[model samples]
Target: MSDYIDQTHLQIYNSNVWAYGNSKWLGYPILKYPCDLFLYQEILHEVQPDIIIECGTFNGGSAMFLCSILELIGKGKVLSIDIDPQPNLPTHERLSYLKASSTSMQALKAAREMITLEDTVLVILDSDHRKHHVLTELNLYYPLVTKGSYLIVEDTNINGHPVSPDFGPGPMEAVEDFLQSNTNFIIDEEKHKFLITFNPKGYLKRIK
Candidate 1:
């Protein structure tokens, strides 16, 4: 019975109506579930990371949202990266834009230089949901997550996690492979309290 209900919810979550409903945030198309946004606020407040590294910058709404939270906390910065530059992206003192592919060596090198060993960091991977791409990103940014901080792998609900059954090996597959050899991080199931998240079991918290 529980499984049946869960499947029904997944179907709704993958429907066009759901997608169209959450297409705006602060005057921009955030393309994110409100539940996920709420979870982010909670995570940010709890972790208070010195920096938030976001791999995919869509219309800049999500980055702007994160920047606002950092401002409220009176600290932290958002480093958002994307292969294509977003025209008219919102400008914020706490936000920095990197117009480069998230998986490129250039971006990784720059990130390494920007972050110090003592800085507390959080990472969000939302670009190139392909299994290989997500796995590469997980490996590259694993070191950036500070102890007790989260590494959020967004959109893991697809590829048969109940959404997009034919999407083919994606974030969920990448996460499964990533956890096999990486013991420093573990999925924090408590984040799933909302029961409707694009990222299922993708809230990894670095324990060491």
Candidate 2:
């Protein structure tokens, strides 16, 4: 019965992911699972981070979503990074778009400049999903996450943790590699309490 439930969950997850490709927020494309988005809100509300460094802004829908939540929280700003310029991105006072590689020094400098010692920070890595690129991003951004905050690695479901089998050494592999040497963070399995998530074993919470 447990195996049957697991199989059913996977089937539903695959279908949801397929439909999620077309998902949008306020008419802007947002490539994220609905369950994860729900979890994001829970995290945002709990952390109340002063800064959210999002390493990927496709059409800016997710950034916009984050901004909306921050507005409700009445504090916080989003620094969304991406290599390509997205013309459709919406204009928001709380959203800053940086056109640079997520792991580039330029990007790092900008992020550092926006953060202060007193601020609580959260990082969301959704940019390059390749193993090396994701690993580099994990290393570069993990330090910015304040104690008790989160470093979310998205799309770990690819490379066959149940979806996109041919994606090849993606975020999941990068996360596993990152954890082997990093002890300050641990996978917060509670984040995925929802049965379906794009980020499997990807929610790393800073303990110290």
Candidate 3:
């Protein structure tokens, strides 16, 4: 297991899997680890959140992928936010797009308006990976995550956790900082069963 871990690190460093530049879901670019996506489906199945607030939309593949899973589950909606809109995003009845800074009040207001007090929400932070930005996002969105749901912070493997040594403090750092004073959420290691996730320690479940 130790040897495999070392080899995985080397592979990630050599191939830059953190970028996921060529990966896609249903033909649309989706820059995320397939392992993490599988874990997401598992969590979605277990938690069954009514709303998913995704902070980064990119090419919208991930949003579509989430909606696909939700469809199979027979419920749920995805609200994907991004600063710059892409050219072609897949349209789905369960998907909504917001073009705005994820940490901006406009984005927060939109998310709040879409979610009712009775809704169980799951939040994903995948935009502006810098520590400060992610931390701000964590503060702003964590409240939306209902008990037993997740507030996923993606790309935690970067910033030298195993790859992209020079990327600087990213999602992992943000999560660490957020956990210091917050007790409502806890890192759910079960999500790491796949062992090849980009989001190390990123699956934070609201436990309070």
TM-score of each: 0.93, 0.93, 0.94
lDDT of 3 by residue, 2-57 (tens): 56885786586467544545677888888777777889899999999899999999
Stretches of candidate 3 exceeding 4 Å from the true structure: 10-21
Quantify how close model 3 is to the true structure by its C-alpha RMSD in Å: 1.7
A best-first ranking of the candidates according to their TM-score comes to 3, 1, 2
lDDT (Cα, 0-100) at 128 in candidate 1: 89
Model 2 whole-model lDDT (C-alpha atoms): 0.90
Q: Looking at model 1, report the run of 10 residues with the lowest lDDT sum.
A: 17-26
Q: What lDDT does candidate 2 reach at residue 131?
A: 94
For candidate 1, lDDT tens digit of each residue in 39-154? 99999999998989999997898899999899989889989999985688888999999999999998898787778888889999998899999999999999888999999999
- C-alpha displacement of 202 in model 3, angstroms? 0.3
What candidate 1 gets wrong by more than 4 Å, as runs, is 20-22
Candidate 3 shows a clash count of 0
RMSD to true structure for each model, in Å: 1.7, 1.9, 1.7
Residue-level lDDT tens digits of model 2 in 150-174: 9999989888887778889999999
> What TM value does model 2 have?
0.93
